[model samples]
Target: MEHREAAFRKLFDLYRHDIYAYGKSILKHDEYAEEIVQDVFLKIWLNREKLDPELSFRSYIFAITRNLAINFLHKAANDARLREEVFYKSQESYNPAENNIDAAYYDRIKQQAIDILSPRRRQIFELSRNRGMSYEEISKELGISVSTVKNQMSAALETIRNFLFAHSDLTLIITFIAFGWL
Candidate 1:
């Protein structure tokens, strides 16, 4: 166990910076790049027993880093698209009163969805949306890495979106706008 731990530590030390650089180049975001580094290393450690010393360790690690970074970007892009769709829908002239629900009812539903979030996630969400703080700003204020803030915010948005979809008659766009995700 000690030997494996030492090997993993050495591997991390050797490749962490290189992986971070690769992720940064691809993502163009420092926080996400840092996350790729951590996630890649965690994956490597978990799968250490499968490590083949005969193969180029650098290549193997870089492949993992690249794949994870790509996945991260894909998810971010999809989330952005969903938000845009919701925003566009919210801007339409449809009247909520036609559906027999007032704006305040939507507000209450939004609050209920928010109330369902874990404490840290709710804080992160509020910082990003309500406080109008950037991910980097929230990270610095909360004394956490930017990646952590981004992850929490992403999770909070998804949770709220799901909650609104399942529990309310409002369209996705209306729910998103009412929840201030736009």
Candidate 2:
């Protein structure tokens, strides 16, 4: 374990700045580039045992970094499209106050959506979202497994999305999402 940690640390020290630079070049965002760095190193560490030492590690690591960066871009593009379709293009959202729909209304819609969740699911969602707690922190606090916390959080979000879709305006739903109520 110590040997593994030492080697991983050495590889990280060697590649982190290069990875960050390459990622920033592709992503054009500093925070996402930093995320790419952490994700690249994490992937490398998890798959270290499978690495072919005789092969070019530089080529391999860059391949992983590029793929992750592209995937991030793809996901971001999808999120951007959602914002475009649901929020920016909507006249109602553009003048929400004129329409008598504001942050408080969005909060009400969010609360209604959240009310549809089961008790345990609501607790997990609130802990993770409202309290800004990490899954591991919520798990420790609730005396539950981390995976259980993750699963419950996923389900809670899906339930809220469905509820919002069924019961509220798309503008309200998107407004909550745009503001990261989910």
Candidate 3:
């Protein structure tokens, strides 16, 4: 174990800066580059036993770093697209007088959508969205696993989205409002 630890430490020291540079060059962001470096090193350490010392560690490590950086960019792009869709839908449905909708009316409809959730799901959704708490924070507060919180939130969002789409004249407007776009 000691020998393995020493070797891993040496490998980390040798490749850490190079990995950071590669990530920064590809990502063009300091924090994201740092995250890539950390993630790559953590993965390497976790899979140290599988590593072949005879092989070129440089190539292996760089390949892992590259793949992780690309995946991160892909997820970031998807998130941006979703945000834009939500914003666009909200703007499209936004007609105060034409739709005969006021803030209080929207609020009531939003509450009704939330009311459709099961009791536990409603609590988790409110804590996460309304209170602006992170899944980790909600998990700690509610004594539930983070995965449970995430699952419950996802279900809650889907349920609310479906209910809003079904009941509202405007398309996905309630979804945008429930998600805090309005």
* Global lDDT of each candidate: 0.73, 0.74, 0.74
Output the number of the lDDT-best candidate: 2
Q: Tens digits of per-residue lDDT for model 1 on 1-182?
A: 89878977887888889999887655555676798999998898888778888999898988787668546544544586644553344446676565555566777887999999999999998888888999999999999999999889888877875575456643442435534573
Per-residue lDDT over 12-122 for candidate 2, one digit per residue giving the tens place of the 0 to 100 score: 999999999877655555777899999998898788889898999988878787778646644544597644643444443365345564666666877878898999999
Ranking by lDDT: 2, 3, 1
User: What does the lDDT read for residue 52 in candidate 1?
Assistant: 89
Q: State every prediction's TM-score relative to the real structure.
A: 0.44, 0.50, 0.44
TM-score of model 1 (CA atoms): 0.44
Candidate 2 wrongly placed segments (more than 4 Å)? 1-86, 92-101
Greater TM-score among 1 and 3 belongs to 1
Clashing pairs in 3: none
TM-score of 2: 0.50
